[model samples]
Target: MLVRPHRSRAVTAAVAAGAAALVGFSSPTATAAPVPGTTVATTTTAVAAPVTAQADILDRVRAVPGVTKVTEATAPEGYRFFLIDFTQYRDQRHPKEGTFTQRLSLLHKSDDRPMVMYTSGYGLSTRASRSEPTQIVDGNQLSMEYRFFNTSIPTTPDWDEELTIWQAATDQHRIIEAFKSIYTENWLTTGGSKGGMTATYHRRFYPKDVSGTIPYVAPNDVVDGQDVYDEFLANVGNDASCRDALTAVQRRALGTDRQWFLDRLAQLTKEEKLTWTITGGMEQAFEAAVVDYYFAFWQYSLQSDCADVPDAATATNEQLWEHLDAVAGMSFYADQTLSNYVPYYYQAAYQMGSPEPYEDRIADLLKYPGFNTAESFVPSALRPVVDDTKAMPDVDRWVRLRSTEMLYVYGSNDPWSAEPFTCGREASAERRECYRFYVDGGNHGAKIAQLPAPERTFATQKVLEWAGLTDADPVAKKVKKNGRWSTNNQLDRPEIRGRALGRR
Candidate 1:
């Protein structure tokens, strides 16, 4: 069912003016009401702690895990480069103890080679702290660091106005501006998920920073983006086929106890279960498992409070995995944020307030206005404000930012498929000369790994080539439609290829 879209006059003006305020591009803040949930920085906290000297910044950055070295340069403008430890950021975000500050590492390489200034996706940590890696020519990795904005902003009119001011000041625009000051010349940039969204916005709002871009599974349509959020909710709303698929799994689990399921899985041979081949082998399986964990881990991770399986290990292993796939289409439990009805429930619920206004706006402005309609996928809680286009706009700005040189990748089975919905004609038409590849039976970003030896070499070589850097293979052929880009094996059928692309 579809709900009406809404726009907050105050929010619209605030965002527009806020965007304008970016590097003093547009007019100053308008007469619209001040944005809710923001606070101006008070003079009181000015002396919290002195920052490290500029000369020492690189040294501190190099110490982080995965960071091989840090380099500072004014080349390509004022930007610095750090060949980072991507593996490090992914692990550290889990956290064991102590307060952690988000950071990025800058790397250096031969100026003659094309460079990439990589940024990361959405998370509680700021860009400065996360160890985002930059893969340079000749297989060198550099990490980039940036700052964070953690001030709590009040969205409610009756809530604290000061906090909201704080958020508006340290808004995402400031984050981008701060990063821009570090680099001068054009470079290609990319990120996945939230990073993807940021990259999408960056390509449009700050085209000067990047020459071309890549956003893996970017949820550009954040307004209706999470329509597939909760499995329970999705089940209630799904059509018969979808409902039955999930119901089958539920019934299977009903009579079985958790321990019973675990024993069943333990008894299965590698060949019978096909778990080993699921991800090529056990070594690769570890990495794939982590990636798979992400879909639900976001909801339960330390950063947010959503839900926990409690006895996750105790759960019926095989049954649990099967159950996960069965109901996967229904759950939007991204790290416990919205999925769990919990202590932090108020925060998620509060975020819902921003979209409440959209529902009313959509009803008044569009043909399929009601929330109960078949076309409407708006969550019940979000139904009240479906029209708040101010919080989630149509992103026409994306058109101005599309690139022909871009390549998109996706796993066909990705849960986010229903929201961002990247594989559409509209997306294809929008970007000129863009190629989308579906990895047969591959998960998100899994195609490159699954490619046969030559294909893998070709794909890896293309990334280097795109960066204007050369490698040993220097693949000259385009990624062909037949999958047999090289003189190797015959490719699979289109449907098989597409289905294999995102089966994670």
Candidate 2:
């Protein structure tokens, strides 16, 4: 019923050591005027375009077939938004790298104000430049994890805890550089879900580049509670009985009923009023399984101990760890490879079927990569960093930097929100150094805030205030009916579905 959803830093001149090595590659600049015709791939580079003509070029492109939304505006004196297009190659190593084009909007709010960059996370299905590009807010929540899922270099060793941490940090630095190159100033950054966690990472890494940040509905305790897969197995069985049945199936499959488990799935699809096909059904089950497994995996990774369960004893950290490890073994991604499910599944369901071949592919991926996880839709050249736990020092340092100026918003109804046992409130006072917005009955950043007009008004007002756009109280004139955040903005009217999530 209620909708749920869901940075940094800089480098030195290396003491002016080696400019050749320092400047690996530079992106072609944009121009105000359109270039004639479609430019084909070529060995010779295209000349840089002028910024003055960027709007005209965009207008011409908008008129082309299949072209979507095109917008051009001189961002206010302090803030500016620009849309750039570039063909992204998944594998820098591959001669024929698949093409990827993305739009980045920059807001340089004034020198006094901070530059705030929003990362897409609500599953943006369309490019940022599309006519009907997804809105910034989805399901009343702002995405905070775009850098990890969308913007960052995809090269990462998925299973190597240390490497993932390292690559994440490296990507974090690159993200800051990207921002600085475009905006030429320090900024505040945020997003939701993927964006949220990224916000955590950003604060964890590039603290100096950002004045503040807001991580909405993001879970930061990835070392423990961020397990979506295994946790789902333990919870989303439709009910306790369903969970029990699934657990039984998992146990049986481990023993003698593997074929039976597969057969039952087919039977359910054919006989029951099942909306999902065998493939789809398996996907769902796998997702739930992954969530649960990840939880156990965290225990093992963090505690560095296996779980043990007696015949009559309840599940322990050890048993779950073993069970999850088994699942990891079965899944090709368990090997040190890239992160995220999309690319891994892409290879499994499409390129390679056998787990062994897939493992080899993953190993190859470790050599050099671009923007892809273990299994990539496109090959990359950037080497995969396997053990990056050393980056933790940088992460913790950055986290402290942004904590002072950041605001973290979370929904109680969201499964990913961090809720500690010691503090029952949305967030503890100790954690409140950074403002944390807790929406009652809200899931992710959905339309729930609209139920009451006062809340809606407050949200709008707060956003504007945060942006340093206006000082007018959106709901100052409205009487406080019950002292709860209320709003008259129709956008907040609970009846309407506020926003939908997208894949960026």
Candidate 3:
């Protein structure tokens, strides 16, 4: 860690005021190499590093181990943004092995402020924004893209070996190690869906890296080889009205109204200009989308109210397709999407558990008997070997017996909530520093802010107490783009996105 003193209250207050009052924080009288493509109107004062200009601070950042490249962007109102490229070993166990670069973005509000490590399941995003945890506390955020994602890939990748949870957690460990030297303060981590799992994995391997973590809607399969999610969807909300309604739609599309929907699928292919060869032609994509409908319904909370369901038997082809498309996007099976998410499916097939079959309700409707949704995505070239019983169960064991200061959030109706992480039946008796909250009928997009009173207040209070903060005001108000807005980089924050959907 860099050897420097913590900024005084006066200095921190001055720095937060504006660039003009950035007294010792900016290098007013020093000469340092300027950063390329970096126009830093203000620089963060890492508690231990020399106070430098925004650009020089980045220059210093480049010197941090694992940080290969840094470039700044115009940030949201009161924040500064930068995209970073960090080098990682193919396997953390052997540094002598080959290396790869993983990409991450930073949104800095101040140096002394607590920082939230935001984990993203996708690499396509280059946006700078605050997370639900960050916004609640109005803190800085370091959003890192998962390894093997589009923006961060090893040149000669081996999906089977390099993408282990331990290695990925180490990828995060390296980042935390490097950045702590600068922003030396309490650190917290958070992610939703797969990203939430990613955060929990890091906490498992390197528990002390962050003060607390909130993993949202993250499923923890027992690794007993059971696809519990199927059971969850089967009885979600314990209300069959909507499930029956959706199943009726599925049956009509795949059973009675099959040919017409097939025609619509072809027409959609032409109109949307999508390719299906990756998933084996247009007809195959149709089958996948149709099967995906029921799962997607609860996964995404497609029906806000059960009364909205159109009677499948009486609904027109257009109505069926609209409802089908909303729940299971027709384009979800597109060539590019399938190709981009190859890593996601690979992870699922490997250490992460893949979904098990629960299609007895529509067994006769399926033409492809053993069509594997995640398996099909793993190209023969990747040498896929699925083991649903490896990674998560161990993580669960750890969370049950060892994890502390961890908060879990979920939607009661979100399909992945089937196996939400738990702290065992003795949670209160054990005095564990862990919490679990499920929105009444929330979906994958559930957030603590959306939770009812005291539970939400308690969750926020715990996170605040963890970060040692008292409030979350003064945060740049998250806003939506009405076309005229300059950017739409907001990641699934509830206030900005109507739905808190995470990665597909």
Better of 2 and 3 by TM-score: 3
- Scored by CA lDDT, what does every candidate get? 0.31, 0.33, 0.67
Relative to the unseen true structure, what is the C-alpha lDDT of residue 485 in candidate 1, on a scale of 0 to 100?
Answer: 32
Q: What is residue 77's positional error in candidate 1, in angstroms?
A: 27
lDDT of 1 by residue, 66-180 (tens): 2222334342322334432221111112222111123344443333334454443312211122111133222112222211111111112111211121222123333334333
RMSD in Å for candidate 2, one decimal?
A: 14.9
**Which pairs clash inside model 3?**
445-500
Scored against the true structure, residue 391 in model 1 reaches a CA lDDT of 29
Per-residue lDDT of model 3, residues 224-339, tens digit only: 35657667777886678878988888899889778899898778678766676556667777787777777666766545656677799788989888877765666565664455
- Select the stronger candidate by lDDT from 1 and 2: 2
Quote model 3's TM-score: 0.81
Best by lDDT: 3
Clashes of each: 86, 82, 1
Q: Write the per-residue lDDT of candidate 2 for residues 1-504, one digit (tens) a residue.
A: 001110000112221122121122111232122221233222222324433323443333333321122344454332233343323333323314332233333332223333455553322222222110011111111112222233322233222321133333333444455434333433456665545555555565566655455566554431221234234323421235433433442453333433543454445445533332212234333232333332222211211122222221254434443444343322212111112223222222221111111111122212222211222222222223222223433443444433455555655434444331111233324433444556654444533242356654454344433443333332222212333333323222222111222111
User: Global CA lDDT of candidate 1, please?
Assistant: 0.31
On a 0 to 100 scale, what is the lDDT of residue 358 in model 1? 20
RMSD of 1: 16.7
Error of 2 at 334 (Å): 14
Q: Stretches of candidate 3 above 4 Å error?
A: 1-57, 271-273, 370-372, 386-388, 425-431, 470-504
